[model samples]
Every structure is written in C-alpha cells, then in structure tokens.
Target: MSSQAAAIAPSELLEAARVSKAWPFEEARKIVSRLEKEGGVSRTVLFETGYGPSGLPHIGTFGEVARTTMVRRAFELLMPGVETRLICFSDDMDGMRKIPDNVPDRAFLEPYLHMPLTRVPDPFTNEYPSFGDHNNAMLRRFLDTFGFEYEFASATEYYKSGRFDPILRRVAERYDDIMAIMLPTLGPERRATYSPFLPISPKTGRVLYVPMKKVNAADATITFDDEDGEETTLPVTGGHVKLQWKPDFGARWAALGVDFEMFGKDHGPNMGVYDRICAALGGRPPEHFVYELFLDEKGEKISKSKGNGLTIDEWLAYAPSESLALYMFLRPRQAKKLYFDVIPRAVDEYYQHLAAYPRQDVKERLGNPVWHIHGGNPPAIVLPVSFALLLNLVSASHAHDKAVLWGFILRHVPGVTPQTHPELDRLAGYAIRYFEDFVKPAKVFRAPDEVEAEALQALSVKLGTLPAGADGETIQNALLDVARGIERYQDHAKTSPEGGPGVSVAFFQMIYQVLLGQERGPRFGSFAALYGIDNTRELIARALAGGDLSEV
Candidate 1:
C-alpha cells in the first residue's frame, strides 16, 4: 500500500522537501549547494542574525529571529545529516550613545552616556548587573518561549575573551584599505577625525571616538590623543579597542565563518562596503538578503525611538505566537504594517491554514502555513470557527466568561468540549481580550435609515414566525427571501437607488451595526441560527422599537 501511494504521488513529492519553492527553502538550497561544491556537508554551516541591544526587544526583533529560524529549519530538512548552527549575536558592547525614550527610568541612564551598554546600570533595577544584560535576558526569555534553538553570543564576551583578537589584528593590518572603503562615505568634517579603531578611555571608561595618531600593526597597538591632549597607547587586540560599525560587521562575519545573514533594506548601501572590507581582508562575505522594514498603521516606519508599534508582549497577549509566525512567513520582503488591527485577520488565517491542513495531500500540505508553523509536524485538530467569528459572538452575546463563550462554541462543533479543544479554548480567551482592547472601544452604533428600518422590521416579524428549532439553511433561505421582499417593496414604492443589490447589502450592514455594533460580521443567517433565532429576533425587535440595543 505504501508503495502504491508513492507511485501515484504528485510530482512535487519527487522534489526536495516539497516546499523548495518557498523563499527560505530556496535560499537554504542555494546555501547547501554552495557548501557541497566548496567542501561538502562535513563542515558545519553557520547562520547568524545580529541584534543591537540598544532597547528592549520588540516584535521586529522577534520577526528577524523567527524568520531566520524558519530558514534554518528549511536547511535542516534539505540536508538531514548536515550540521548547522543558528547564532543570535548581540552587539551589547556598543556605546549607549543616547538613552531610548521608550526605556524606563530615562533619568538614571543620563549619566552613563557614551559608556558601553553592558557597563551601564540596569534602569529597570531587575538586578541583571547592567542594562544590556537585562535586555538580553528579555530577548532570551521570549525566544525560549517560542522554543527557538539558538546559541547566543555577546559582543562584550567575544571582545573581552580575546576571541575577536584575530579579526581585530586583521582590521589593524588592513586599516588603510578599510579606511579607503569607509572615508568616501562620510563628510569631510567626520573624515578628518574618523578612525577604524575606537579606543575605550582607560581613565573615564567612556568609548572614545578620537582620531588614531599612529598604528603599529606589527605590535597590534594603536595610539590616540586623550581628552586632555595626552597621548595614550592600547593593544588593539583585546577589549581595549573596538572597530567601527562597518569594519566590525565585516570582521565578525569573517571570524564567525558565517554562511548566511540578512538585514533590512535600509542597509543596502552598507552591504557593498562591508563585502568589500571582508574581501580586502581575504575573507568572503556571507550569502546576504535584504528584507524590507515593518511599518506602523499609518504606513510610517516602525521605529524603536518613536515607540510607535506593537511590542512583542502586546502581540502575544492578543493573539497566539503562531499567528505572528504566519505574519512573518508571508512576503517578508514587502513592507507591511504591524499593529493591533492586523492581529484578528492573522489569527483567522492561522486557523484557516490549520483547518485545511488535514484534508490536503502531501504536496498541498507542504505549501500550507501550518507545515512551516509546526516544522512539518502539524497537529491533528480542527478549529470550529474563526477567531473573528468568536469575537463577534463574544460581542453580541456579551460573554464575559469563557464557559459562556464555550457554550456557543460547543453548539457549533458538537461533541468537542473544552478538553477536546484546548487550542480553541485558548483562542477564545484571545478573542475576548482582543475584543475588549480593540473592538469594543471603537464601536459606534448607527441607526438604520427609514427604508432599512422598515425592511428590518419585516425581517424581524418573519424571524418570529420561524419554528423554534429552525435549521441554519432554513434560516438562511428565510433571510434571503426577506431581502428579495424588500427589493420588491422598493420597486412597488418606486424608491430611488433602485432597491437592487445595494438594498440587501445595506440591510445586512444595518443588522451588523445595530446588533454587533460593527460594519460587518459573521454570515447573518448562520450567526442568527447559532446565536438562537429567538434571541436574534428579540435584538431586531429592540432595534425596530428604537430601544437600547447595547444589552444584546
């Protein structure tokens, strides 16, 4: 039987992983092919993603790591026996430069300006030793929650332990070449004082940006003038000196033997410069990709300094992490807005993919988001309804308790209790939270127009005449007939706007507005049947009588 199934399988089954068409899988295949040509899979492939610990980790940070890990997973699937390492490298040794406005206790960080982030005191007072340590811990906590397998590297440790010493020496030996690649990009004022090595002041413990007076490459030492015009010499190897951003990036790539890395498109100009620097130092740059930046709701770039987008915590609170993963998986190169408004649709899409996964063959299932979401082991379960439908139910029923929402859910999907549907139960909670935070507050009830009111009145009377246990199909037909009747009435009355398709659409909009306090919602007939025809008729009657519809 297994052989027979394989014989009739789709052509994609004969391909690599059945998902080679995806961007991540294609990139992974390219990397594997390159590695095979170079030295074979005996050597380990390194995938590196960089993070600047200048502020607390946000959703964008999660996006980079999650997307990189997806590619890493794809690489593993393509080369099952090969060794791969995904490194989450943190540049924590960077100078504080300026305190971010989004961080807590800004006044405390004021005195530590120009100091290494790892040396600055923790403003949140979590006793993590330094601000950088606290932020790094937060990054680790969320990554762990997402079950990411990665090795974390700190710049301070790499520098202080002399692990970067060889790269530092290389940068020193190729100082003139690196300077030539960098100086042309800067203005004359900055070029006059620019140096590849930024020495930390031994006296004040501040990152000094002074010009290098002399460099003894043979001894790995750089001499620079201090703040008081006194000359100071320091070994360029240890933590005593750090390379500037461009040189540092290239040196790190060479030292780590990185095979793949990506950054935002805003850094496009620096890509060639870094590649050139690496080439001049006799090292090749990694396979690179440039992804677009995430934007805010207003189509403005989401900036950490501006504090204008949803944080990771905020996203997780209102939706599952899988929803965010799906969001990251879709068209990463295009600029998409990240805000609370996108959460509901993403949640629904995640469920849609999961619900469709089981019915698909190997080829179609491989292309499903659930396959990537679960790392090729999608679970066996079905969501009864969409998160949007649940939110609408919660809003219409005023379900303040999970049991109350589950009561309606069990009605839709019979025999699937809270125990059998734990995932749905959790989603119900997310729906309630999302409704409270984003939906309820924005709701504005609009009274139906005169024609819409008469149509709704007739629909309510027809609903009242329905049998107590009418089926969904019957209720749906009744609703459609009511819409048709309204069109006929408009034709007889000779009303403007023709009472054509727009009349039914307007009547449904009025129902959603008066009943659910929105412009759109679940299919009205199904909603009416599931919510109980008697209760829906009561709500409609309340709307017709000009009474308060809020209680419904």
Candidate 2:
C-alpha cells in the first residue's frame, strides 16, 4: 500500500471492498487489484466505454458511461493516486447497414445506405455534417451536461488519421488466424465468404464485405473484387479498410491498451472471441464486465433500433441528472425497468441520499452513491420536503414558479433559497412539468361519501384549532389522529352496514383526489405540515364545499 492507502483506515478499505461486491465497484476493485499485481507498468490505466452511432444517443448510452464513471471513481478511492483515463469511443466508421426508422426524413437517407454513418447526410438538419456527427453532438451535449470527464474518440477520425495503422497491419498479418476463430461462430453460407478486412469500394465508395482474394501482409495491402467483376487493391493502412465487428472490438482493445471495458449482456457471448483475437495479436484483453440490458415498461428489451426505451432528453426533462446517476449506480448485473414512472422515486431517493450524506461517518459516506454521484463532495443543503411533496404542493397551490414552491420550502428549511439549492429548484420545475403531464391527465375526482365528508369536516375543524406556527411534526400527528378517528368511526359504523362512509383506502384516495386531483400522493401528514395549517384547512374546506377544487 502507498502512503495515501496507508493513511486510510483498514476498516474503511474493507468497507470499500465490501461495497465493490455489489457492482461496478466490484469490477473496479478486481481490475485495480489485478493491475497492482502486474508490476513494471508505468502508464495510466485506460478505461473505455463505447457507443455505436447507428441512432441518436439514448438512456442506455448514458447508463453505460455513467456506470463506468462510477466504477472509475470507486477505483480511484481504492487505489489512491493511480493515474486513469476514460475514453468515450464512437464507432462511426461502421457502414450504414440500414437507415434507422426513428430518424427524421428517412426517405432522404435511403440514397446513402451502405455508406459509413459519417458519410451519410444528416436528414434532420444541415447543422451537422452527417448523421454520425449529429449523433456524436447529442452524445457530447448530455455528457457535458452530466460533467463526465472523458476523451472522445471517433472511429472515422482515428482510422483516417493512421492511428489504427498498426492494428490494421496486425489484422492483415493474422487474417487466416482470425478467420479460424470467427468461422466457427457463423453459418455455412456466411462462413464461405466472411473476411476480417472489409475494403471500401473505390468505385461506389460503399464498404464491401466480399471475401478478400489476396492479402499482402508484407505490403499492408488487401485485394478484393469491387461491385464489378474487376479486382481492386487498396492499402489497408489508411481508412481504405475497416475490420468487422468482432475484430474491430479486439483490435481497438489492443491498440488503445484499454485496461477496462464494459458492454451489455447481449455481447456477453462475444467476450471470449474478442479476448482470443486480442491475445493472438500479442495484446491482453482488458478487464471485462457485462451488465444486463434495460427494459421498457412492457418488459421488452430497450433497443435503439426498436426505439422502445426512454431517451436521455426525456429523462432530463423530468428529473435531475443526479437522480439518473443514482439510477445507474444500482447493481448493473440486474435488469432495471427504465420508464417515466420511475422518475419521481429516483428524484426523492437522490434527495434522501443528500439528506443523509452529512450525517454518515467517513467510511459509510465514502461508500454512499451520493458520494460518487457528486464526485466525493455531496451538497450540504437538505430540503425538508421530498420531490413527491413538492409535486403535490405544485398541484395543490398551482405553483407555476420556483418562488412559490420556495415559499413553502423556506418555512421549513430556513436560510436556504432557490439560489443556494439550485438542484431542488430545478427539481421543482420538473415536478410541475411531470404533474402537468402524467398526474393531471389521469385524475378523476369523486365526491366523498357522507360519513367520509363528516370525518373530513371534523378534521378541518381540528386543523383550524392548531396554531399558525405549528411545525410539520405537530401537523402530521394531528392529521394522523384525524385518520385514526375516522377509522374507528368506520369500524363502528360497519355494524350498521352502509349506515356511514367507511374509512378504508378509499378515504385516503379521496383526499388525494380532492387536493392534488390524483388517486395517490405523498404522506398526508408530512404534506399537510409542509403545506402549512392554514393552506391545509383551505384545501380540506374546498374539497368539502363541493365547489371548484381547482383554486385550492
């Protein structure tokens, strides 16, 4: 152990190793321990995450990069002062096998089929040079917004700049050996013509997948037949040739000296193939981690081609980036359902972590997801109210502005303003938007029955008796007393069999429907306390009055 590692308590290190048993951190610990054992290494450890620029960036892309970054952070915490580099590699040189159906103006991209994504015109707008460029821009935009520290590598640029020349030569020299490894995995028809090197047609500029007639390893050139019957020869050193998927993956690992890489479980079967190819070319494969894929609400696998999952933009619109980071911080080996419905809980969970961060001890704090989400410096401010409560406040009070929400917030958490708690303020906006979309549309208000109405009336009277300066706990207890009283009344009234309204789940649902125009909401007590006694009385009276419940 180094001085820094020694400075850290052994118990703390043990805790970190224990946290690593969960996920990503587990993989990070494995990689760091393995690398530590391999002496004489004086280079920075390279951690790479990649994207296939076939479609616009989505939540899965964000998840992969975000999770890898968390692991990188965990690695840093475990092995202090170890140099590390993270690269977001984009495979933009891959030919446009087909124009994605989700893109705008698909008809316009038809002409560019079979060309590299970098070569296809961006059908959405001329703002970007090509489809690949536009997608790369979107990827970088969110990455920058999330504050990920990474170096972006474009396959098109890397190949054309001769940076991959040595790998290309290695692929050429080991073509037969690579074929031996790949052929067994393909069908007979595919095996008959499969070649590791895919030479771009000099005539049509399309990437040709035809079998290589001859490979001159000494000359670093390959010979293949073009679209016509004529044979063509091109130097593979430049961008004239690109390797197939499996070989490209292995070659990239070998060329970049990637120490850690991860992919979806769909690629789990291909790990050994890439590892073998990399080892064959005198390069050891990186430490690999495979995570399960995200699923949509219907339990279908989220796919870029299927356009079935939530997009990163949609997620950002409804929740803070930290919430999304927390979602990614969970165990990666387990499949997670990603949809809009999960947003509110994620938002509240992030706030909970922030609230708990300062109170935790140093060892526990280091292992907290908030520590990684905030890069070891979690914010000190804690909102007394959760995001769900904020949403109810937005709906109940018609708070169209952050100032209005802060009016309630400042009452509980004094000395904090929208300026100091920007994340909370941002969440307030998302809450309002989410309330408008998901909550408002589905609300169906039903009048409370007679006994229930009487209970609410009694609750209102009790609330009015409370002092104006009553705290949340006080208000919460009063509200619970009202609920318990209603329940006792309902239990006695049950003997009469429909003589009075029953205080069941419907009672609480009715309250939610009346105040927030939803069948479910935050805890009534906490909400009542945060919303203030006076406001609570007004909302309850409005619900009982059978007048317009909107003004409450």
Candidate 3:
C-alpha cells in the first residue's frame, strides 16, 4: 500500500526476489510471467477480492482482502511503475436466498426473500436504504480502518448504470453455449430449469428463476414466464438480468480485466466453470490462488451465516490487528482452527518477527511475514517480553490494572514506559483480558501427585538456594537440574513408554498445572525471571499449600 519500491529495491534484493522462497514472491512471479506472455503490463493490472453482501462482512472477509493485498504488494515491488488497481467487488444485486439468523426484524425480511439484496430493507438502522448497503458500508469501514488501498465496486451500481451492458449483451448472444457448459454440473431437477440470465420480475420486483421461454439474441432480451404465467420480455442489458453466481464470477473477470484473484479451497471445484464462462465470453481468466479454509472449534468450516466461529470483533477485543494479519499470512494453504487459543501465540510471533527484522539480511527479511505485513518496512516495535511471559506475569502477580502490571514491567525493563512503549501497554491490557476470559474460566488446578510434589519441593528448595539476583537462564538451569535429579522421575524418564513424552516436557507440564493452574505455560526460566525468583518461590509455596495461584 505504501510506495517504497524505488528506495528499497536494490540489485541484490531484485536478484534474490527472482528466486526468493517467499510465497508472495512466488505468486508475483506467476503474475509477471502471465503478463509478459500477454501484453507486458502496458495496461493497469487489476487485482480483485470478491464478497457477497448477504450478511455483515466477517473475519474471513478481512483475511481475503489482507492476503490479496500481500500479493498485490509483491507485484508492485517486482514491476515498479506498472500501474495497479485493486477492486473489492460486492455482489449486492444477488437475490436474498433466505433471511439471516443474525439480523434484527427477521419477520420483515420474509417478504423480501428472493428479492435482490440491494432492494431488501435494512433490518438494523435506517442509515442505509437496504441491508446490502449497510453491510457494504461495514466492509469499507474495516478495510479503511486497516488503511487498505482499494476501490469498492457494487454489482447493483454496475448493473443499473449499464457498466456491464456490453458483457451482458455478449452473454445473451452466447446464452445457449454458456448453458451447455453449466447444465451437466447440475441434476435433472436443476438442469430442467437453468438459464444463464435471471430476469428481474417487472410485476413482483423479485429475481425470477423460471426458464426462459424464448431468447431473442438480436434484441439482447429474454422472454420469460412471469410469476403470474404471463410471457414477458426484458433486455438482458441494464439491471433487468443478472447472471448466476458461477457465471457472474467469470463475467465479472471478463468485464473488469482482472489479472489476479484468490479464494478458499471450497471454490477449487468450480474453477473450471468460472474459467470456461470467462473464456467463452471473450476474456482471459485471472491467476487463481486457493488456500485452505478455516475451521471452527469443532472442525467444521466457519460459516458467516451460522456465526459458529470467531468474529473479527472478538479477535480485536483481545489482540491487535497486526497479529491477525500475521495469522492470515502464515501457512495460508494449510487449514487452521480460527479460535481464541490462537491469539496469544499470534501476538507473540508477530512481535518476534518484528524484533528480528532489523538484524536480518534482505533475503531473510523478504521471507519474513512482517516484511509483507508492512510492505517491506516493518515498524521497530520491540516488545521487551513475550505475550506468554506477560500473561504469566499477570497470572502470578494478580495484576488487575495497568498500574500494577507496569510496576512489574518497569522493574524488568527499567527505561520502558507506557508513553514510549504503547504497544507494550496495550499488550498488558490484552493479557489481562485474555487471562480473565479464557485462561481463568478453563483453568483446572489439581494437587500435584507424589512424584510431582517431590519435584516441586526440590525446585522450591533450589530456588531458595539461588542468590537474590539470579538471572532467568540461571534459575532455569537450576530448575532443570532439580527435575533431572529426582529419583522417582529419573527412573521413569529412563524406562518410560517408547512413544511417551520426554521427562522434561512432563516436568514442565506438571509445574504449569500445579503452580499456574494451566496445563501449559511460557518458558519457565523467562517467566521466573519476569516474576522475580523470590516471588516464584512464593508461587510454589502457594501451590503446595493448595491455594489457587491462578487467581488474579
């Protein structure tokens, strides 16, 4: 989104990019090769992200836009001075198939069923004329909030203003050919009623799904039986006709001359259909990037309609947008569960990448996600501690506010303050919220077993022996020695189950559950360093006495 191509694109960077192992770089190479064969970027390359405005835009919507922007950004670096345009296209003109489960005034939408979404009444506020307009506004708000650079295109406006007229007429002329391509994909019931163009009913103001009685290619109109069985003819041009979803996908590409686009794995099966229709309509299909879809906690696809997965609002409440962008950037082709448990790790990794950027070489920086996240210029936001460490600090110290948490932080990082390190302050607040909402409610604290109790006793005595100023690694090494020296665990460690976990892992897991009231935790050494060694010993004492150390 920011123009740093000229200043940052050195010869070495360019050479490395030619063979860079980054996914965005690989994607950009595809665009570069395609454009070279076609026309060599003489015209502006168009990148598009599609949306259906049946409901408010969700986190998945944000993710698509964010990922597409990453590729668009890569293209900019490789082909600097080549004009690029990104369009976020919304199919608002599509008919409302059913009332949404999340909207207000559900009874009011029943009558508008099968009507165009742009024509349906807004169920929330009267700020917009229709539900589609409201949702489109919400989409733009979040996109703009993140400062994404793109143009917004509405299907209703494009159709009503005759912008798609040429394509519409061409589709009408080849109606039979397009139908031949689509008919075999459906069953007999659907094939018997399918048409390339769905005519908007003049009488009932609904999108009619009936078969075309007659098609006049010369007039660019279809004669269809209306809701009342009356034969009516309407021009396919203008807003009278809209193509079905798959055809619309191809037709839109043809109309806009899209160069690059991407979607989830769910759309992989229909790529052939989209490509054929675009080719049949005299347009080249754009390069496609299909990523695995996100699953909910139960491993089902995250459906915006069902509201079964994490929403954008829920994530922002507990983490920063950069963390979300990082989550989207990593392993895009692999399916990940979009759940609350991912936020803390994402936040920590994002900063870890940012902190590592300055020291890395150009090639190494190019492979890092933060380079793409910040358009090759990641901010120098150094977080002094890990997010896990911060959460553990709040866990052990019972910090209910910034004032108390900052006390611990200032001691760990003497010069850092809220005014200078705002990200750190925000992270403190997020850690508290996350701990309260997720960790506290889910914590299962049980008294340590005899073997674990022996380990804890040794660890406590070992900590008490260390000097007042013992460092994190020092305390950590001492704790490890204690775990390895325990006779009961030592025997189990040597002759354990073949596939079982290492004793070191079991040792940490026991300490985390017993002392922190959680099944896992941050690096014990770093955490002990953050929460002073003396304080850590007190935590061990509390756990041994059967007190809830998880409370804050």
Per-residue C-alpha lDDT of model 2 across residues 427-495, encoded as one tens digit per residue: 888988998777767667667778768878878888888887777677766665566566544444443
Could you tell me how far off, in angstroms, the CA of residue 15 lies in candidate 1 after the best superposition?
1.2
The weakest ten consecutive residues by lDDT in model 2 span 1-10
Better of 2 and 3 by TM-score: 3
Q: Which predicted model would earn the best TM-score? A: 3
The better candidate by lDDT, 1 or 3, is 3
List residue ranges in candidate 1 displaced over 4 A. 1-19, 465-474, 487-504
Identify the runs in model 2 with alpha carbons over 4 angstroms from their true place.
1-22, 410-416, 419-422, 486-507, 550-552
TM-score of each: 0.92, 0.90, 0.95
Mind giving the per-residue lDDT tens digits that candidate 1 earns over 428-533?
8998888888898888776777877877887888888888677667887677667766653333333334454423466567778876789887677777766777
Model 3: ten consecutive residues of lowest lDDT: 1-10
Better candidate by TM-score, 1 or 3: 3
For residues 330-368, what per-residue lDDT tens digits would candidate 3 score against the true structure?
Answer: 999999999999999999999898877777778888898
RMSD of each: 3.9, 4.6, 3.1
